[model samples]
Target: MNRNYLLNDAIISPLGFTTSENLTSIRNSETALKLHRNSRYFKEGYYAGLIDLDWINSKFSRIGNPGKYTKLEKLIILAIKQVIDPSQNFSTRSSGLVLSTTKGNIDLLNNNDFSADRIYLWKMAQVIADFFELKQKPVVVSNACISGALAIKTANDFIESGRFKNAVVAGGDLVSDFVLSGFQSFQAISSKPCRPFSNDREGVSLGEAAAAIFIDQEQSAVGESVHYIDAVTANDANHISGPSRTGEGLYQSISRLFNNSGVDPSKVDYISAHGTATNFNDEMESISFNRAELNYVPVNSFKGYYGHTLGASALLETILTKKCLLNNELLASHNFTESGVSVNLNIIREHKRKELRTALKTASGFGGCNLAMLLQKQSL
Candidate 1:
């Protein structure tokens, strides 16, 4: 199998506009979630991490023309433009684009100002590909919350299969009245900042963000890049809205990830979990980790810092995980006050330093979908 490496990346979130800015804010234990009493998304005030559209427009106009792109499209283009360097001689024919999102322009459907005819996922993808001038047909993945992680895996597969030398993977989802009301109807939106694995946890806090990551089969210009060792995705089909009680899908995904990489469980330094703070989701993760014998590993959830982020969570979290490996530190599982699940986990409570060699990222989403990926620091 060909080795795949993360070349460069960028993030556009409420924490900060750049990757470095977001990392700094997270390290400081700052959260982007805020109380929006007048939000049109829900009847009462809802806490969410939202990007200022006015700010987005100001920054976007400096880079390219506006009105031609939707808010989501502008976000994707902005993120990709930040990390992509024009000096690099990679060919458009050999490079591809992959986008991940759960609800692409679903908000446009209810808007009388915008035509619903332009709301198709493929049409949105074509706009992005044309903006970046990628020659290859764009790939779009919308598999619940695992969409972002699966997008990276898709890019890795394409590069490893000799189909493309490089791929630009961008994932994002904007919070809107449509999505918020849907979660609200399910009673899954937390009233406060979500506390993953905490006894008093309520539910998930939705967030909006756009992030782009570049992957290539060739050596990275950036020194000592993280390598994509392997990834596996599984489905339990327990329910359309809930995960399997036994965590069967997640267990199988993690098992296959290690089996494919031949990496010992003891070597995994940290776990970036899909801790949505909801009762069932967090409990399901505890069960999955224990079954994999990974309970001893230090774990943390980024949801407390960025809210759920929906489709952007996995990709955004992966970029932050790479930063954690680089810094050799484990960030705390923010807002966790006590153990709430049956299975015990070594959830990090404070930022601590450690030599991280290997890490695992996992996410389980609606539709009983699960994804696990192994990342290793490039040996110097």
Candidate 2:
């Protein structure tokens, strides 16, 4: 099987517009999550990580007409543009595009100017595909919060199967009224910035972000890069909204990946978990990690920094994990002050330097969906 190598990448979020900027902010223990009192989203207000629209328009004007695309489309285009090399001509026939989003242009439903068809997910995918002049039809992944990770897994499968030589995977979501209300109805929105896996942690703080990465079959020769080793997704059919009490699905996903790759669980140096700060999700992850014998691994959640970015969470977190592997640093789990889960975990409470070579990124979403991906630094 052809191995998939991670190439260039980009991130547009409240933290910064580029991947380097985002990583630097994280190294300094900075967070973009804040309290928003906007009545448009919720009458009682909520906490979220949101990008400044004015900044986005100013930056996007240099690339293309901002009026032609929606907010989410602009974010996706800007992210992917940073990954493409203008001097190198890409083969349209051998290239693929995969878009991941739980709600693509869902905010457009309230806008009167756009037609009803503008809200269609497939139509949004077409718009993104046309922007890059990609000849092949794009693949869309929208399986709840696991969409980002699943999209990358889909691209890996494509490259390994010889369906495409390379692929561009992009994901983004906005904290619009539609999204805010849905979570509000579930009483899942936290009153303040989220505190992942902390004793006093509340619920989730919704966030918005756009992230993109280029994956190719060939590895880069210039600097350190990570490659996809194995990935798996499992469903416990536990419930529609709640996770399995015993973490059955997540445990199964991690166990399968390790068993198939023959990689010992101890080899994993760091973990980027889906610690949403909610009682059930965080507790469930603790149970799952203990079951997989990963209790001693250094674990941290990016949600405290970016808030649960829904479809973009997994991909955005993956980019940071790649950076950590190359820089040999371990980022502290922002807002984690005290342990909250039942089983004890090696939670990273402070930023520190370490010799990181392997990482495990996990995500669990609604509909009983769970995903796990193993990544390793390329040996020189």
Candidate 3:
């Protein structure tokens, strides 16, 4: 196999914690988003996706130094334990760890006045490595929201380069006062959950989660076959924190994937957009689609299903996209009743039944970085 990034396997998310549980949730359109009334900003309350802390908490009463870890990291470490245990696959010979988090310990700092220097990025990576005894120094990617994609891409590189035989990339973040206050201060937190692409759109609701995937270069038959990271990380230096107004970065990234993979853009059946439901993000993404000649690709975002998990946001969405890619079933774009952006786009409404051979993922973040990853179906 001459493939660049082969995603030999993946697990499901949001619902049905296992791969089967998550697939059943999507097939039935059962949403994990709930009405969050206990938040500081929500005097009356708004809907959001929250992992059942108490439930999962009781299960992980044994992780050492759980107090030092942020709520997000705890959740992620627990999730990682579910997939990776020291007894079976934690050997230091071939396995490696890659951790993704935007506010690694920012939440901890906000909750307590800890020294900022103590919040070094390397510490977060070490926590996971020690927890599982993988012994390999983990690579941390914290490029704002694109951290998860970056981590996955980094893991792919490690495996392809023969540095490791199996690299587990885990993405996670928790809803904390630091992020909530920041979004609310910017007037971006929706009073209601959010109405992405709707005529009565407000803004995005903050969400928290931990999603992990095991990417082994060795092919497996049990998990669904969604090729992992076939194409990734085409950078665009367009803006400091927002998407390129003209989508040049997005265009270039998608173009690079197609050109390098020899897969025509026209062959792509659907797209999982960064659809944050914000005005600029939606508008700029539409323009990027047009510029990339992908205006026709049916686009959807799983953000509606799970607020946005900062570091885990892209990872959660990527896993969902992989599920859809394997099942030949696409998710509804959700919350798009009208086109608010400059260009009219194909927003998936009902579940799309298409032969999704290849699905393109487009994501941008603070510091003007754009990423396009083309994931392909398993060969027949």
Name the candidate that leads on lDDT. 2
Q: Mind giving the per-residue lDDT tens digits that candidate 3 earns over 1-380?
A: 33433342233334645556666776676766678778677687766776676655554677655455555556777767766653243356568788888886676574454445536668766766776777677878888888887887888878778887777788777777777878777777677656566666677876767778777765555554767645556555766756777877777778887887788889888899888787777777888888888888888877776666678877777777887887788788765677788887888888867787788887877777778887877754
**Candidate 2 at 314: error in angstroms?**
0.3
Q: Give the per-residue lDDT digits (tens) of candidate 1, residues 248-268.
A: 999999999889889988899
Candidate 2's displacement at residue 349, Å, is 0.7
lDDT minimum window of 10 residues, candidate 2? 85-94
Off by over 4 Å in 2: 40-44, 86-89
Model 3: weakest 10-residue lDDT segment is: 4-13
For each candidate, give its TM-score against the true structure.
0.97, 0.97, 0.88
Each model's lDDT: 0.89, 0.89, 0.72
Whose TM-score is higher: candidate 1's or candidate 3's?
1
Candidate 2 residue lDDT tens string, 1-380: 55588778898899999999998888888888987888465676778999988889888899888888888989999998888753142466778888899999999987965668879988998998898788988999999998999999999998788777788899999998898888888988888899999999989999999999988877656667899888899997899899999999999999999998889998999999999999999999999999999999999999999999998999999988888898899999999988999998999999999999999999999999999999899775
Q: After superposing candidate 3, which stretches have Cα over 4 Å from the reference?
A: 1-16, 42-46, 62-69, 85-90, 110-118, 222-224, 234-238
Clashing pairs in 3: 7-228, 16-21
TM-score of 2: 0.97
